[model samples]
Target: MNKNPVDAALILVFLYPLLKGFLFKFSSKNMKSDIEEIGGYISFIIGVILGTYLTKKIFMIHQDGVYAKIYNNIPEQIISALESKPLLIYVLVMPIIIFLIYKVVQIIIDLINSITLYPLLDSIEDLLKGKSGFVKRIIGLLFQLPKGVCYVILLALVLNVLVIIGVNDTYNKKLNESKLYGNICKNIINPITNSKLAKKIPNVINDSFKIVIKNSEDQPGNESGKTIVYYNGITLSEGIKSNEEIDSFSRELVKNKKTSKEKAKIIYNWIGQNIEYDYDKVDKILDNDFTIKSGAINTFNTKKGICFDYSCLYSAMCKANNIKVRIVTGEGFNGSNWVSHAWNEVYISEENKWINVDTTFYKGGNYFDSSIFKLDHKDRKIAG
Candidate 1:
C-alpha cells in the first residue's frame, strides 16, 4: 500500500516469490509446466514496463508541478530574457530528462530481478558484493552526478518557457512605438530645421487677397451664427464646437481668459502638446474626410492625425475661444521634399497679422520657430 512508486516497486519485487509460491501451490495438477513458466515470464516483463512507464510519468508531473509555481513568481524582466534564448532552455532541461529516464530504467530492472527470481543474481547472493559491488557503486555515483546536472538544466528551461510568450508581445509593441516616434521626427521637423534662405524667397506670401484683414483675436465676431450652441441644457457661446470633446476642451482652456492672445496661446500650446501627425493619413487625404466634423473629433480623441486633423481641431478650439482661425491647405516642404500639407493661421491682436501655428510641427519638440512659420506654411484655400 506504499504510495511511493519506487518503494512499492521494490516491495513487489521481493514479495513476488511468496505470491508465486502460493499461486503454484493452488494450481491444478493437470496444468502444463510450460504454460506456467510462460505466464511467469510474461507477467515479469509486463510488470517491468508498466512500473517504469508510470513511475516516469509520476516523477515528471511532480517535477513540472513544482517548477510551475516558481515560474509564476519570477520577475517579468528575467522571463523576457529567458524566452529570447531558447538554447538556454535546452541546456537547462535535457539533463533532468536523462536522469529521470535512467532512474526509471534502473528501478524497473530491479523489479524484474525480484519478480522473476533470475538465476544470475539468486545463484550467487554476493555477485554484486565485494569488489564487484564497489564497481557498481562507482558507476551509480557517476550517473547521480549527471542526474543532478540534468535536473538543474530542465528546471531552468521550464521556467524560461513559462515567461517568454508575454515578453514577446511586450517587445513587439515597444518596437512598433519606437518606429513611430522615429518616423515623426524624421518627417515633420526635419524639413524646417534644415531649411536655409527659405525665408528670403519672395513667393512666401504674407497676404494673397486684396481685402484688408483685421485682428479679430478678441473681436468676439458673430460673422458665423454657428458659434453658439446649446448642449446638456446649457447655452454655450464657443465658435469651435466641431465636436463635443473639442468643445469641452475649448471651454476648459479659455474659461477665465481675459484676452485673445492668452486664449490663442493656450489653444496653440494644447494642440502642440496633444496631437501627433498621422503619416499614413497623408496618402489617403482624398478618400478620408479630414474636415472639422469627423477629423477634428477623431484627432482629439485619438491624439494622432494628419496635418488636416491638426488644423481642423485647432480651428475649432480657436473659434470657441472667440479667435478666428483658418485651416489653410497648400504645398509645403515635409523634410527634403515638397508635399501637399495643412496648417493653421490665427489672427493675432498685438501683431495685427495672421500667424501660422502648425501643431504637428510643435509636437515634435520646442524646435519649431515662429519667425520662419511662413517659410513652409504656404497659404491655399482656408476653412473656418
Candidate 2:
C-alpha cells in the first residue's frame, strides 16, 4: 500500500532491471568515469529525482475522489509518526545513507577490476585457440561484460528520458494533444515526413508515426448538460416536473433499505439491468450535432446513452432517494481503448467514505470496486 508511483518507477529504473541479473540470471555505463562510477552515481541521482517527484504526485494525484482518502491524511500520518519517533527525519534520509554505501562498494569494485582484469585477459586469446563452437562464441561474448553493462546503464537513461516526458504535466499535455502524438488510427502518407524515411532506408519504418498512449480526453461533463435540459416547459429533463416518476423508480429499489449501501446497490442493479448503451449516438455526440440537454432528464426518459447519460441519470435517482451523491468525471479503460467517462460517488455513512459507482461499466459483467469504479478509472475532477 505504499501507493507512491514515483518511488515505484524509480525502483523500476535503478534497481529492477539491474537486479534482474540476480533474480532471473540476466542483466549494465562511461568514458571520463569507469563503469562502477557511472552506475553508482546514475542510480543515486535517479533515486533522488524520483523521490522528489513522489512527494509531489502523492499530494496532487488524489485530490478529487475516494482515492483522496489515501493521500489526504498523509500529513496527519507524518505528524503522528514524528510524535512517536522524534528523530524520524533521520530515517527519511535513509536513501542518502544507502547511496554512500553504494559509493564505497563501487570504489572496491573499481579497484578489483583495475588490479585483476588486465592480468586475467593478457593471454586469454591463446586459451581459446582451437575453439570454434557456439560455446566459445558465448564465452567470448561474456568477455565483453563491461561493455554490455555500460550499454544497459545508457539504456536505463534513455528509458527514463521517455518517462520524464510523462511525469511532467506540461510535457504530458503537449504530447497527448500534439498531431505528432495523435497520428490517427488511419495511416497517412505525406511528402515531407515520408520523403526522408524513404530515402534513408526502404520501409524501415512502414508505420512511421510517433506512438503516444494517453488517458481519455478531458471533459467538464454533464453538470452543464443537466442545466441545458431546462430550456423548454420542463419535459423529461425536468426531474422536478418528473418527481412522481423518480418517486416511482425509487419506491421499487429503496424500499425497506435501512442502509445507504443497500440502497445504492439496488439502484445500481436497476440501472445496469434496465438501461443500455446506444452505440449509434456516439458518432453524433462526437460531431457536436446532437443535443447537449441529454443529461439526467434525457437519460431516465430514454433509458439508454453513452457514459454521460448513465452517470447523470443515476445521480438524479440518488437525489430522489434523499441520498448524497456527486457526479465524477474521469477516464476508463475496458482492457483495450481508454475513453473519457462519467460516474457517481455516493457517501455511505456506514462506510464513512465515498464509494465509486460506475453504472456504465456495470454492464460489462462486474463493476463493484467502491475504491475504484474500475481499476482503470482515474479520477480527474469533481462535479464536472
Candidate 3:
C-alpha cells in the first residue's frame, strides 16, 4: 500500500531470498551448503565494490597520463583509434583488472574460511538443527539483510555513474520518479561522488568526446564524421553537380596549365579568391531552416558556399582537369574552436603525392600543399 510501488517492489526483491531461506526447512547438509554460499556471496560483493572503485580511481587519475605517454610512440592509425573512443580502451582493459581483483579476493576469503570461519559456521548449523523455525528465520534474516544492503549500495553507485555519463532521458526520468532509489542516491551515493575523484569523471568523459571530434578523420560510417559535417550535428548533403559545367569552367581556369599540380593549384586559388563564404547559409543551417539548393552548381553560380561547398567545387574542378581528388569532411579550426568543415586532398602525379587544400581558408593563408595543413584540417573521409 506504499505510495511508491516501484520502491516496494525492489524491497520485496531483495527480501525474497531471506524469506525463502527461512520458509524452507533444509537438511543438515543443505544448511551447511547454504552457510558456505553466504561466504561466497560476501566475497563476490567485496570484489565488485572494491574492484569497481579501484578501476575507476586508476582511470580517473592516470588515463590522460597514459594517453600522453603512448601518443608519440604509436602509429598515427592507432592514435586515430584512441581519439575516436578514448574511454573505450579503458572499458575493455578494466574488465581484466576487475576479474583479477575478484579472483584474488575469492582466494583470500576461501583461505580464511578454510582456517576458521567454515568450522565455526558448521558448529553454528549444528546448534540451529534442533531449533524452532522462528529462531532459524530470525538468524537467516539477520544474515541476509547486510548482503541486501550491500547490493542496494552497489546498484546506487552504478546508477549515479550512469547519470554522470549521460544516460537516456527516459531512463533518467523513471529513476527520478522512484523515491526510494532517489534517497539511496542522495544519502548513500552522493557523498562518494562529491569527492574530488568523482568530479573528475564527468570532465574526463567530456574531454574524451572533445578529442574524438577534434582528431577524428571523416570516414564513410563514422558518427563523428556526421557530427563534424554541419552545425548542431547536421549531415551535409553531397554537393553533386554535372560534369558539363565543371568541365567547362575548369578548362578556362586551367587554360594552358602544364601539369596536374599546376591545374590543382589554379583551381584552389580561383575558388579561394572568387567564392565567398556564405554566412547566410551557415546561420540558416544552424537554425535548421536551410534547404540543399544544388550543392556544387549553386555555389559555382552564386560564387558563395560553406566549407563543404568550397571543397565540392574544388573537387569538381580537379576532376575536370583529371587530377585525383577527394572531398574530405571533418572538423576545422577557425582560430578558436573546431567546427564542421570540408576540404580537398588532391593527388599530384608529378609529385607522386597527395596534399591537402582548403579553399575555404584561402584568404587565411596558403593552405595548398602547406606542411602545417594537417594541424587544422582533420581529414575525416572522402566525399567524392
lDDT of model number 3: 0.61
List candidate 3 segments past 4 Å from native: 1-6, 25-41, 63-80, 87-90, 154-167, 187-196, 199-384
lDDT of 2 by residue, 1-384 (tens): 544443344334544334333333211111213344545654554443444234223332344455467566757876466435533322353345445655666676667756765445445545656756554545544443544444444443333334332344444334333332223111222111122221221111111111122232332553432333221112223422335776677766798898888888888888888777765566555454435445665667778666666766777777777778776765554221234566778888788978778787674433543332333466456653
TM-score attained by model 2: 0.40
Tell me which of candidates 1 and 2 scores higher on lDDT. Answer: 2
Residue 73 lDDT in model 3?
A: 56
**Clash count (model 2, backbone only):** 2
- In model 2, the worst 10-residue window by lDDT is 202-211
lDDT string for model 3 (286-353, tens) is 55554545367778889977776777788778877778988776666443223456678999998899
Reference-based lDDT, each prediction? 0.46, 0.49, 0.61
Model 3 TM-score (2 dp): 0.43
Off by over 4 Å in 2: 1-242, 371-374
Better of 1 and 3 by TM-score: 3
Question: Which regions of candidate 1 deviate over 4 angstroms?
Answer: 1-241, 283-294, 364-369
lDDT, candidate 1, equals: 0.46
Candidate 1 lDDT by residue in tens digits, 1-384: 324432333344444544443343312221223233434443433333343333323322213565556556658775565445433332444334444555665566557654664443233334434545445544334323323333322332232223222234343233223333223324322222222222221111111111223433444754533343221111212323477667777989888877776788788788877776554444334343333223566677788765556666788788766787776666553432234455677888766877667776663322122433443445365644
Which candidate leads the pack in TM-score? 3
